[model samples]
Target: MTSGAPSDWYRWIPEQISARDYELLPEDFCRTIEVVDGHIVKCESPSRLHNRVARRIATHMEAGRKPEPCLMVDTDVDVRISDVPLSLRRPDVIVYRCLDDDAKLYAGDTVLVVEVVSPDSSFHTDTVEKKAAYAAAGIPVYLIVFLTEAADGIELIEEYRLSEGRYHLVCLHTRRLTVDSPIPVDIAFGDLASG
Candidate 1:
């Protein structure tokens, strides 16, 4: 019996997929796509600046976080928002509860989700669509970081908290970000862009 090459195993994916189907996809393939409303959406590679900002933010958050809740901070991780229609989003940086076993991270487990605005990102998609989705999923906090015009650094960080089943702007930090919700966070904006 002759076995086919690994490439031969590749098959055309359907336009829509369930959460279970998504879970079955190869880990490499899953890194390049996100599921929205049961549909497959390819994710564009983020710019270096975008990645840097996210990493820096996650590092700072991890340092400032309280140890009582035993939260875990991560970058570029899938967050399951819904199961019925299967919606998932990969947040640039996420603060979630530490789990005992290796398992999927759901929206309910998320304490805060951060999205860094990339040069190619659509304003509506980040500010409107994702904002609404995270709020609907009952995520406690959402942070949107806007890059500078030159695309070299962070310009503003808008923190939104869920209230009355909706997100209300809590603060817009331009220089340094300081917040005490879900956990205490204090990060100097300059440090985020600096080498």
Candidate 2:
């Protein structure tokens, strides 16, 4: 009912949430939380360092993106993967090859989806359930940027590409090791981690 009540909204399916009901949600909740398969999943906000890195990446990519455009950077937007009668999820960052001008509630298919890993988030679900969901939804690229440790720790990046009805890890690298994906874009972990 109300965000403060903390009812079991997680148990609902996408079809269960009506357009009218979704509008009743709280306005000022700190972290991003979404309902998927009736489960309430909380998303992590970028740390000052994480925000800096994301901005840097966006800037670099923005400079290189051409004609067709690789993707549009949405900081924190709600995306509807499926809606039947119950659940939903608003990922941290969604990169779409095409930006929707009229979209207010949510957008359609996205090319790449990225989530800067947060220690507070339920890593198992994000890395497992949501990953599978994105893959099933046929998202071309999924990037998980790890920013969970203290002491300015390791920045692990894993890039997954969908193929043959599933997602496979195409590349993996740490901040100490700079690596490029077989895809068109090159992400420098070392460069991103510092920012």
lDDT tens digits by residue: candidate 2, 1-195: 454433654443244455445655554541366766544555555577667656655555554556554456665666667665335566655666565666643434577776666656557766988799888777777777777454544457787888996889987866542323212455556566564
Q: Model 1 Cα displacement at 135 (Å)?
A: 0.2
Question: Candidate 1: which stretches are off by over 4 Å?
Answer: 1-10, 150-152
lDDT to native, each model? 0.84, 0.61
Q: RMSD in angstroms, all models?
A: 3.2, 5.2
On TM-score, the leading prediction is: 1
Q: Candidate 1: TM-score?
A: 0.91
> What is the C-alpha lDDT profile of model 1 across 1-195, one tens digit per residue?
113223432464566787766766777878987889999888898877788889998888888878887898999989999997999999999989997556989999998999998746646678998999999999999999988864337788899999999999989998887878776778787778776
Off by over 4 Å in 2: 1-16, 26-31, 44-46, 104-108, 148-153, 176-184
| TM value for model 2 | 0.72
lDDT of 2 at 11: 43
- Model 1 lowest lDDT segment of ten: 1-10
